[model samples]
Target: MKKILFLTFAALLMVVSCKKDPLDQTPDGKITLEEVFTDKDRTEAYLSTAYSRIPDYFWKYSFFAFLAGITDEAKDSDVGNNAGNIASFWNTGSLSLSTNPLEAYGGQGKGISRYVTYWSGIRDCNVFLANIPKASVANEDYRKRFTAEAKVLRSFYYLELIKQFGGMPIVDKPFEVTFDYASLKRPTFQECVNFIVKNCDEAIAEPQFPLRITLETERGRFTKAVAYAIKSQALLYNASPLWNPTNDVAKWTASANASKEAIAALAATGQFALHPNYGNYFLNQSDLSPSPGDKETIFEINEASNGTFSVINSIPSKPGMFKAGSCPSQELVDAYDMQINPIAGGVAGEPAILGYSDADHLQPIINNSGPGPASGYARARPYVGRDPRFYATVWFNGAQYDNINGAIHTIETFQGGADQLIKNPPNRANTHTGYYLRKFIDPRIQSNQPHNSRWKKYRLAEIYLNLAEAENEANGPTAAAYAAVNVVRNRSQMPNLPVGLDKDQFRVRVRRERRVEFAMEEHRFWDVRRWKILDQTDKVVTGMEIIKDPITGAFTYNRFVTERRNAWTDKYLIFPIPLGEASIIPDFDLHQNPGW
Candidate 1:
C-alpha cells in the first residue's frame, strides 16, 4: 500500500512541474505519486526541492539584490540598463504592481531570480507534508524529521512574505485545479502572524528535530534553533511601529517574551556564542560549519569559493576588479561612534566624543575645536579614533590593502588620484561615495583566487539585538536590555552605552548599533521600514569628496548628496502584491496594499 502511494506522489510532482500556471496544483494522471515516495532517494529529493527557494543573499543578483543600494547604507555602481541590476530599479522608484523587482509569487523568469519566490516554496512544502506519511522508508524517525523540516520551511516562507507584503493568503494544503482560486482571501496581519508562529511551534515540538545541527552533511537543514529564530523574528516584526501603530506595550511584551525564550533555548544547548573576532566572522573559511566552528551562526547559506564579490565590490584600481559595487555611504560612515578616550594632554571631555555634530550629520563633531593638536575626531582627519568595526567594514581614502602578490597598496580616493571617481567619461567601476565595502570581501581573494563565502542568515548577535530592542520597547531601558546590547558592542571592543539613558535616548542607541553592526549584511533596508523611519533615512544619501592640495600637502573634506531617492513614501512601508497575482481572479480580493 505504501509503495503504491509513493508512486502516485511522484506522478503528481511530474504534473505539477510541467504546469505554467503559478496557482496550478492539479496532479495530471501520467505517473503515480506512490512511485515517487516508494523510493527513498525520490522521497528525499522532493524534500530537497522545498529548500531550493531559500534566498541566496550572497549572490549579487538574488532577492533584495545587495539591498544596501536602495537604503542609506550604500549605492550600487551599476547605473546602466542591465536587467539583473535590480537595485537600480528600486533607486529610481520604478517598482510598480506590474513591475516589482522584489515580488515573491511568480518564479524566476517571470521577474526575479528562481530563488526569490516563496509561494512556490510553500506549495512544495504543503505537497510534501500531505504525501510524506505514505512513503515506504524503513526508519519512522527519518519520516518524522522530514515532516518537521517541511513545516519549518513553510513557516519561514510565510515570514519572508509577511516582511515584504504584509498579510498574505494562508494556503496550508495542496489544491486541485478545480479548487476555487477566486474564493481565497488574504488574512489579517495578526492572523498571519499566529499561523506562522503556530507552524514554528509544531516544528519545534518534533522529537527528532535537533536543537543545533552537528552533522556536516546536514549543515543547512532546519533545526530547532532555526524554528525559534523564525518565531522570534516574526514576533519582532509584529511588534514594530509599522504593524503595531497603537504603540501597544503588550505587543512589545509578547515579542520580548518570544525573543527571551529563543535565547534561553539556544543557551540550553550550550552550542552558540559570539564569534571571537568581529572582523573575521564574516570572511573566516574555517568557521563555516555550525558546531565547533563559529557557534554565533545560527543559520547560514554556504557557497563555493568564488571571487565574484571581489571582482564587483573591490577597489576599482585593484587588478582584475570591475565596478566598486555597493560603495559605503557617508551616512553609514557617520554612524560609527568616535572612540571615547582623548589623546595625550587633552582633557577627558575636551574633544567631541560623538561622530557627528548634529543628528542630521551635516557637520562632523571635531576634536580640539580651537585645533592646536587634534585629540579625538577632527574633521581634517575624520576617520581617526572611530569604532573598530569601521576599520573592518569600510575602505576609506587612506586605507591600506594587502595584495595577493605580496605587496601592500595604499588606496587614494582623493581628487585626480588613481582611484578617484571619474565623471566626464563616467567610470562605473569607481567608488561614488569615496569609500568601498571591506566587510565581506576577503583581502586575500584576487581575480584568480575565489574565497569561500557564507551568508550568516541568523546569528547569535542578531538574536541579542532583537531581544534588546523588544525588551526596551516593552519595559523601557531595563538592565536586561542594556546587557543584550552590550554583549554585541563588547565583542567589537567598543565601550558600553552610557548608563542612566532615558527610553527615547536608548532607542536611538539601539538603532545606531544595528546600523553599524550589520552594515552591509542587508539589515538597514528592512530596519528603516519596520521602524517607520524611511522618510528620514531614504530621502538622501551623501558621499565625501576629498581634495588634495599638492603645494601644502593638506587635504580638505567635503560632503555631497550622491543621489536623491524617490521611494520614501509611507506607501513603501510594505510592497504591493504583484498585479498579476493581485488580479488573478477578478473578485479574488487579494487586496493590494494601500497607495499602490
Candidate 2:
C-alpha cells in the first residue's frame, strides 16, 4: 500500500511540474491575462510592433543616425562642430568597411554591440511567436488575430537581418541553451530569400494587419502593405549582382519572379498608392506637424513628434556639428549627371546643380548670373529642371533652405566658415565630403535647438525604387513601374522625364537617384553591396565648387576642397560575423570580408 501511494505522489508531482510553468495561470480559480495570453494572445503583440529602438550612440549622441546619410554620394559639413572631423565611415580604407570596424578599428565601443541588440528584438518575436499556441486567449477572435501578429513581426525581423548578416537561421521554436547554434551554418542566399518571402506572405494574410484609420494606425503597428514592400525589397535585393549567384542564371529569374509577385500582392490588396507632391518628401513646412501628405509617404516608422523624441543620428548637429562623424565623400558627388542629363530631376537637360566650387567660387556661370553670393560660392548649375527631389535632399550652395518655421528659409550663400574665416574653429566640415544631409530632416529643425522632430523609417520612394528596379530587372518597363519612378521626381517639382529610357542607362540613373535621394538614410552602402559594385568605391575623398567668373565671362576652376589623403581600405564590405559566434562553432570556416 505504501509503495503504491509513493508512486501516485511521484506521478502527481510530474504533472504539476509540467503544468506549473504556465505563463497565464493565476493564484485564483480565474485565469489571468498572462495565463490567457500564454495560452493564446501572444501572437497579437507579435503581429503588430514598430521598428524604432534607440541604442546608446544614436539615442542621445545622434551622430550615428547619419550612418545612412554618409553612405550616399552626398556632401556634408561639420557646420561648426567637431573641427569638421565628421566624414569617416564612407571614406576610410578604400572607401570600404570591415565587419569589425566598430570593434577592431573605430573602437566604436557600444555602437556595434548596441546595433546587434536589435537581434533581441528578433529573438523576442521568436520567443513570443513560438509560445502563441501554448497560450489560450479567452476570445477565439483574439487568438486568430494574435497569430497574424506574430507572423508580421517575424517578417519585419527577417527584413532587417538579411540586410546586415546576409543569411541567418530561421528559428521557429523556442531556443533551448542546448540548441546547437554552433552547429548551425549560414543558409544559401535563396534559403534566406525564401524564408523572408514566406513571412511577408503570412504577414499580409494577417486579418489584423494594421488598418490605417487614424493618425497612429502606423504607430506601433505593421500593415499588409508593409509586408509586401519588404517582400518586393528582398527580391530586388536578391536580383542584385551580390546575391544572384552570377553563375546561376536560374537564381536571377527566381528573383525577378519574386518581385513581380510582391507587386501583384500589394496591388491585390489595394492598400497602397503613391504620395503625390514631391516637396512634401521631407517633413513639411509646419514645425509642429509633418505628414508625407498622402503623396510621398507610403509606409514609415513613427519617431516621436517631440523633437526630443528620437535623437536624430541622421541630422548633423543642429547649429553646430557636435559629433565629428558622417561627413561626405567626393566620389559620391561626382556621380551626378551633367545638367542636361538630370535623372532624378525628371527632365532632360535638367540643370545639374553640383556642389563643387573653387576658393573664389563666387564667380557666376552666366556672365549675368554674376558673382556667387560670395566669391567662390560653390554652386552647380543646369541645376534647374533637375529632379525636384534632388534639391530637397541635398543642401547646396546658392539654393534657398527653409528654417523650421517654413517661412524663414535661406539659400546657402556661403560655406560654413567662408564668411567668418576662423582657422581655429572647432566645428566645421574639413574633410573631402563637404556637403551635409538635408533630405531626411525637418528643414525647420535649427542647429542644437530643441524642438519636436520626426524621422521616417520607411516611405513610398523606397517602394517605387523597389518596384522600378525589380520590374526593370524582371520584365522590363511596365507603365506602372515608369509611373512609380517618375512620380517621385514629378512631385518633387522636377521637370517631366521622357519615357523610353533603356535598362542599363535608366538602371544607373536609378541607382544614382537612389543614392542621392536616400542619401545618409544609409541605404547606398548596402545597395552597392547587393549590386556587387564595391569595387567602384573610391579610396580617397574630396569635393568641388562650381565656379563661374562674371568678369571673365567664362567657367574656371578656382579649385574646390580636397581630402589630400586616403580614407578607405578594401575590408569594408561584408561585416565579419561576430567573432564570438564563430568561435563556438567547429570548423567555423567563416572567412571575414576583405578589409577587417
After superposing candidate 1, which stretches have Cα over 4 Å from the reference? 1-30, 62-65, 80-84, 102-116, 285-291, 343-361, 364-375, 423-426, 585-590
Residue 560 of model 2: what lDDT? 42
Q: Provide the overall lDDT of each model, using Cα atoms, as 2-decimal numbers.
A: 0.75, 0.47
lDDT of 1 at 348: 32
Best candidate per TM-score, number? 1
lDDT (tens digit, per residue) of candidate 2 on 1-596: 22212331111111121333443233354653344355333334333332332222312222333454234353334333432223433344322222333322332223344325545556556555555666656675655555665665566666666676566655654444224444556676578778878877776676765533234433445556566666767777777776775635455455556545654555345444455544454453212113323533444433334443222322232344333234444445444433233233233422233332442222223211232111111234433433455465555444555553345444332334321111244244332244444454555565544533245455556766776676666556667557656655554554434566776756765676677556656577678777766554433334443344556744333234343223323344455555554454433336433444
For all candidates, the clash counts are: 17, 90
> Cα miss at 332, model 1 (Å)?
0.4
The root-mean-square deviation over C-alpha atoms between each candidate and the true structure, in angstroms, is 5.6, 9.2
